[model samples]
Target: MARSGNVWSRAGVALFQLAEYLHEPGASVGYTLANWNISFGGSVAMGAHRSSLREPSMVAAGVLAVDIIDGNGNIRHIQRDESSDEWLADSCPSGITTCTV
Candidate 1:
């Protein structure tokens, strides 16, 4: 009985940490806002009820990186020139790995 409570307590703490990290703008490519226009967000919910057996829950985590665009067109792994604004990125919100509202 005590062991079960410990497990859920850890899960709850992890959920809170993840929520805080998501609030940040995005992962820093250069540790600055030059190319820090990435999007990373999701919803997390947890509820507890009286039960003898523990129910499994699904948790998913993934990266939301920018799709690069060189002078020609959309491509993978195109280096961005932070000094000049010529480099481009896809309109991030619409472009996601497998994002959902």
Candidate 2:
């Protein structure tokens, strides 16, 4: 849904505890997203997955629409595939920094 403009971040990963289970292994991911028709430049689509030889692996993708926030609490918008010296490294590639959803 990120690639299709229906998700928030372009890249994200789900995490679970390392506890032992007696049944077959599996993971569950779920979330709520807001709707917006706003358009902006560029997107960085990426994904990853894991599976056993007999199981199916899943694929995912997403995008970014807003540019950056200014020093005076203003938001700036930029063209697709375009970058400037003003963009902050922490914002452009918004990656998850935690081990849980």
Candidate 3:
């Protein structure tokens, strides 16, 4: 969490929890998914999202980085600006990774 009300979480965190956390007095996510039961990692891997012309398709725009567990069971730290992960973040859902933000 930050002074600006921006909060970051690990992949295990569920959207429901995030929604609740973001529900501070006057804060909310720019984009929201109807089903809040999904895990952050699941959302990212499946590219879950909602369409919007003004706002982004998903909350992925807010993600700074992701540490994904590759097929080999190794943790891969991918930054938002990396070409491939950039595509992943834009094309994928929103926030994700394994244990860390």
For model 2, residues 1-101, the per-residue Cα lDDT tens digits are 21211323222222221111111243222221211121111112112333334443322222234344555666566433336433323224333431110
Q: Which pairs, if any, clash in model 1?
A: none
The residue ranges of model 2 lying beyond 4 angstroms of the native Cα positions read: 1-61, 82-91, 94-101
lDDT on C-alpha atoms for all candidate structures:
0.27, 0.28, 0.62
Give the C-alpha lDDT of model 3: 0.62
TM-score of each: 0.18, 0.24, 0.63
Better of 1 and 2 by lDDT: 2
1-51: candidate 1 lDDT, tens digit per residue: 112110112222333443345446442111111112222222211111112
lDDT tens readout by residue for model 3, 1-101: 43454466885888777767777754665566646788765665566665677866765655667676666777777767746744454436433443322
The most accurate candidate by lDDT is 3
lDDT of 2 at 98: 12
Model 3 residue 60 distance off true place after TM-score fit, in angstroms: 2.7
